[model samples]
Target: MNGTMPRSSLATTADVAVRRTVGSVTTPAPTTTPLRLPGVMDAEGRVDESRLRMHIFKNGGVSPTERGLVWRFLFGMYPCSSTALERPLLQEQLAVRYQVMKRKWQQMLPDSIRLRLNGTDAELVEAVRYFDQRQAHAQQQDQQEEVRDKLAFLELQAQVLFERVTFDLEELQEAIRIIDKDVPRTDRDLDYYLGEGSGNLLVLRNILITYAAFHPEVSYAQGMNDLCSRFLEVMDSEVDTFWSFSCYMEKFSKDFTADGLHRKIELEAALLKELDPQLYAHLVTDNMESFTFCHRWLLLGFQREFEHSDALRLFEILSCDHLELISQQVERARYQERLASKHSIVPEDNLLTEPQAINTDFTFELFICATILLENRESLLRCRNDVQLIQFTSSLQGTLDLNFTLKKAEEHFYNYCKRSAWDYMNGHCRTRKNKDEHFLYQLRSFFS
Candidate 1:
């Protein structure tokens, strides 16, 4: 994870700003030639980078072409924002411009495939090959309808993003297939099965640097295939998908940085210190301290840590609000238990022999991590090995009862930030450290 930087998130601030300005959009320089439709460009015009850094969210909005363009980028698959949202975009002129966009997409696609874009969903699919099935083709008139034009553009988009790579031994046959697939002839509808499009390298590069904005320590590298793939899956419209993916990457930017990125882990360890002085002391005395295992679990958004379906649910839930209760709760518990466990140790006994009761959602939802810690605690205290402690924390996996774990964690907060989950989420803002540190600090007294 050290080599991987966060992907692009450039459009998030722009989307908010653009939304405000859609009402007051200005017309662009008129040109006879088709402007690049699908290529990545700053849909929003320039801003003073230094001054607009934070308030990019409040800037003015889109052009007629820009709205049509941004609409696809921001919402791609989410329901199209109501046209009413763009009521002030001088609708009459914009409609004419959008028609030009339709023509541009047609020019890029093959004739057969282009024809299919005019029909209904079934007709559209029929014009193109599906992943597993083959069907007969159909006929089309020469005249272009507005609906078909827009539909053609969307179909072309679907083909580019959804097309899968093929593996056939005959190189010549594959090449012929590729050429035939691209060129359309006569009245026949072309296969909508996708072909390739030019990679938006600029947008991708921007994604990397912009994602790593906070931590200049990290380099913007590649191999973010999974994130990009998922982005395409959710967003068919190129611009919308790109922007939404940017928003999704915000929480992960820091972790994607270089080895020096330790703000979260450092904070986690700090929370531990504030929580339980005794455990903290024992960990220090034994050279067994710091919680680093949770790094990957947190960094990759726990991709490898949980099952497939569960990952989606996690993303969906995270997207639902600004809630980060689990992280906060775990920090609190780790801190509190540190205090309790410190006093439990006999002078002659190793620190591992003393248990710091963990009250955290992670104990249950991701209870596996806690179990691993507990299993290794005895040895950790005996050897007081810091490196081993780091390794042990990093190895946990498996799906879990997140809500139950949270409930269980709440039970341990009896003397700390004891607010119910609902209350804590709604208004509680003691900075998880206080509640967590208090909990751990009391552990010593509880067992003393």
Candidate 2:
């Protein structure tokens, strides 16, 4: 597993002051015209849900120009059915709300508050414990005047200290400090974050800090920067970028939280046990928690496993939930040809039926994880125990092929669908309806 920098570290007073100095957001000017998806949007710029779904499912990704707009729909930040005219107004409204949320912490931060923010969570907890003990001792010394005056002074200071700590600004300060350290470390190899002042790298950090202020509950998680980097790459406007990232977090925050991380690890373990019993048994026999390796996979959604653009493509496809649509389109085309000629033979291994493109429901990602494990299954099973298994899994950081991995993921998904007796002759996989039967009949009649 990749080492995670903890969010609990304290920052210096100067660092907190620097963050507080920039209180307002500077909206980045639009640099290029937003590209529209052709068939997916009508003349009025309203989305065609079925067409959009099928296009993304079949194509895997949109052009770079069209990606931000497409992702807004995928993330549910902008409604798929919404018109282009409606989006700007919606974004304006969100941007106002976003600024309001961000300003709360900005207004409250001060030098005394900055000093109070410079403690880890454990340190803060211990501070509170010591205060309570001193208070208790103060009660016992009530008969001594000199000690009582000093105790009163100490009690007043403690009350002020706790008051500062209770402000949302304090948490925001801590999160910003952590983000400052982590931002420069983000994707440094890429040209995007390389420049010196107010670059996209700074924008990425701003998004994270702004998000921490807004959610406050999941203030900041370590791996969130990876998720935000992908969002920034797609969405140009900071407001759009921030909201879209928030929308992404809505579904995934649990995977990053304290309790939720463990639960997901266990969930993956149980899923592996069900999907590939042999691999699961080998893992348990070695006494390795599924999370020992699966943590990074789930945390960043295999972002590190592939190239940057490939990761973006994978994320957009996964967000759209259109894989089943593509499968139906392929089957429908094959069925029509078959109906047109009585002897028309569909190849057992048709090119269109292969899992060339992948749709990523979180469940679909689990399948991808399964595929990765199975890809490495032989080596894993050969391991004497957990040590060698962990070694193999951890070393898979930068070596996997996104395309091959996705193809295998799709195969796993299809086979799982098959094992459950997935209806192929039927049009709707989920509902088991023959939606294409009418088209099949028309083709047959025309040929006759």
Candidate 3:
């Protein structure tokens, strides 16, 4: 555990008192503060991120009301150190920027197509360029031939424009159709997703579509709908959901890619092999590869394993970078306080005291995968064949305790860190030529 929490608990009083400030205005405290997760947030409504992270690490997850704002920081949509007052300004700026991007795609239609639909087109350079090229080329041809050629060229240009617009529209329609297929199936058991003509469903669809438009490269993967559902639920506003989802995709979009999946699958197998050699051998003997059972875990970050609320908490703790800058801030403040005290010893008994430095190397999920496989090691070892092993691991869905899993995963990760240090010190680790070499070198340097 990071540190034990304060003993006092709230009954009628607020669990956390955050001063509600918007822009330059500060709202007075409510007569009745709503029940919230104890100590995760401050009186200013800003997250005490380091404490919140450790709390979630020890306790599994936060209350439902706190998950929304907590997830914003986790998703990098909001900085951990940002004040409540700055949030309004930042959100307003992102809202404007989102509009600009959405409008950029919306205005991709040609004037002819836009005029027919009575939708104004702000981007007309393509059509203008086509006419300009035609005029320039026409000057070189015979007058009679040019007239005939102009008609043919106009027809061809119209066809090209129609085809281009048709392709774009087709892509959009496909994305919508895919989203439509998945939206109805998204957490339908929950009352929030149920009911016909739900506005939340519309918001979910729009966020996915907007993401598809922004990232045309990986347009609307199957699991993307499930991913967007959390964001939409957490953030009530459509604009906020869109931007938050976009920010989340920065790290998560890798899972949606073929190469990304392969990398994760490889990493999972390697980590598990290192963490539990016996389990690895059993899996290999049974012909059960990590990809067979671990793909979903990587793609969704174990969202399928735990309950919705628990999964949210697990993600927040996993997303925490241990606040390195905050650690530095603490160090600087300590130095200054000691200096002010005439070189007297400064107390190191603060709640934010650094304990085990977690290797925030994006391998926490790998550790979780290792823990899952290790948890079922006996059952896995009992399996007679690949089918049995695959079936057993496949059945892990919805049966995991987020708190236990995290605790076990952290243990495994600390072991990995030790092994990593040993291997680097002994020059037993592989020397890879890639983008990650620098990171490995840095880790080695830290250890050395």
Candidate 4:
């Protein structure tokens, strides 16, 4: 997150001026070799994450062998600053924590079964006695007092676990029910998850259950099975997949909520208005401004729109947030330059006066959505209503061109940056303090 891009690395004013002559914004194809292990890692074992992200952005993606490790960094399973020595220790810690959380939910199952089967107290006691016998066998030589102390400790621990289960049981049961239904249905056509009895499907279920059990605030959602499947496919290990999926959910868990999804849809509509006003107007006329047709695309990270492998590639690309990161660095450098210049006139706008907020808007995803729409602008325009629009978009399943769409999205992002720089230079920047608005502002100026 804290890396510098040489000024020459990004598109410049001259490039923007020449954009018209060139017909469209075009990024130079990456010349450096794609980063691999050992090279991506320094002698100290710290990853140059910014460089890795930029490489993915420029080169499309990494080899499958490289992707698992790269995604570990991108999704924050391992910090960019953590050394190789620290990661093993960190993994051990996470593994222990994961097991502890997993047991919390698992321990409730006996009680759950008792309730479901209407078992008598005597039967429940028999079940508890079986586990106690194992503990007694392990501690046969312990003094009577020591054994009593251990029993007391166990009683206290059970009380705590009981309280947690009592509070969360209803919600957790509902989450598990939904997850059971969704897991088998998620990406079953793919070779990795193809069979009804795929072990990977079980791994996917455990990760989602663990996530739901612990994160009650955002508990299991329908789309999470798809998201977790992607991580499990790459990471493979159950512990690793759970931790990585949790890290990713830290940022995106809100997307599963009604409010969060509405906000994203609104942002997409606002962006479409800027990028293609005529199309936006047509949707509005047809009362389709909600843009619900693309809801699955956004929710699942376009998992259904592209072929399986390409969708995996696209997920990592979106995770990198390279454009937003670069724009943040550029803004920081410009802010510094302005402060250093004695003759500089600071604007009254909050954008100039206040400290810049961390950029978490994930605008690149919206830009990619806009790129998809604009790519099909003619076809979309020909549709007279929302039903036709949804049908046309649905028919594009596994048919969109990944490379072409990605390149166009990158261009749109670069053009957005250039246009924002132009607006800021001309004293036209609004007093508002959101980075997403800046993206929309730039698109407005670019189209104008």
Q: Write the per-residue lDDT of candidate 3 for residues 1-448, one digit (tens) a residue.
A: 1111121211112112333322111223322232265775566656666676656555555667766666666666666566565565455444434444444445653321121211242222233334345435535543354434533443343233323322255676577667766865677666665443243554565567657765666668999888788777766556667767877776678789888888878777777777778777777763555445677777877887887777776666666643243334434443443343444333343212222333333367777777888888899888877677668877877889977787677666545655544332223223323323322343333212
Worst 10 residues of 2 by lDDT: 12-21
Model 1 ranges with Cα > 4 A deviation: 1-240, 250-252, 258-260, 277-289, 319-395, 409-448
Error of 3 at 271 (Å): 1.0
TM-scores of all predicted structures:
0.37, 0.65, 0.61, 0.70
After superposing candidate 3 on the true structure, give the runs of residues whose Cα lies further than 4 Å from its correct spot: 1-59, 96-167, 322-362, 384-386, 419-448
* Model 3 residue pairs with clashes: 17-43, 18-43, 18-45, 19-43
On residues 1-448, what C-alpha lDDT tens digit does candidate 4 reach at each position? 0111111211111101100000011112111233364456677678888777877776677789878777877887777787655565455434434555565577765443112221443433343444345335544533355434543443343344334333267887888878777865677666775432254565576678778876778888889998888998887667668878987888999899999889888888887776788988887774454587878999988998888889999998888876677666656555654554335445556233333332336377898899999999999888887888888999999998898898788677665555445444334334335443444443333222
How far residue 227's Cα lies from its native spot in candidate 1, in Å, is: 4.5
Ordered from best to worst TM-score, the candidate numbers read 4, 2, 3, 1
Report lDDT per candidate.
0.34, 0.59, 0.56, 0.65
Candidate 4 local Cα displacement, residue 59, angstroms: 2.1
Candidate 2, residue 177: how far the Cα is off, in Å: 3.7
Q: How many residue pairs clash in all the candidates, one count each?
A: 28, 1, 4, 0
Q: Tens digits of per-residue lDDT for model 2 on 1-448?
A: 0111122211101100010101234333222243465677676566777666556655767778778777776776676665555554455445544554444444555332222322453433343444445435534532355533543443343234333233465676788778866765677666554433225665576578767765666789788887888787677556778877877787778888768778767667766775789878878763665446777877788887777777787777676665455445445664554454345343444313322222223266677788888898898888775677778877887788877887777766655544332233322222314454433332223212
CA deviation > 4 Å runs, candidate 2: 1-38, 110-167, 323-362, 385-387, 422-448
Q: Could you tell me the lDDT of residue 219 within candidate 2? A: 81
Q: Which candidate is the best by lDDT?
A: 4
Tens digit of per-residue lDDT, candidate 1, span 240-319? 34345544554455555554236655544443454444444566553554555555554544544444445433434333
Supply candidate 1's per-residue lDDT for 231. Answer: 46
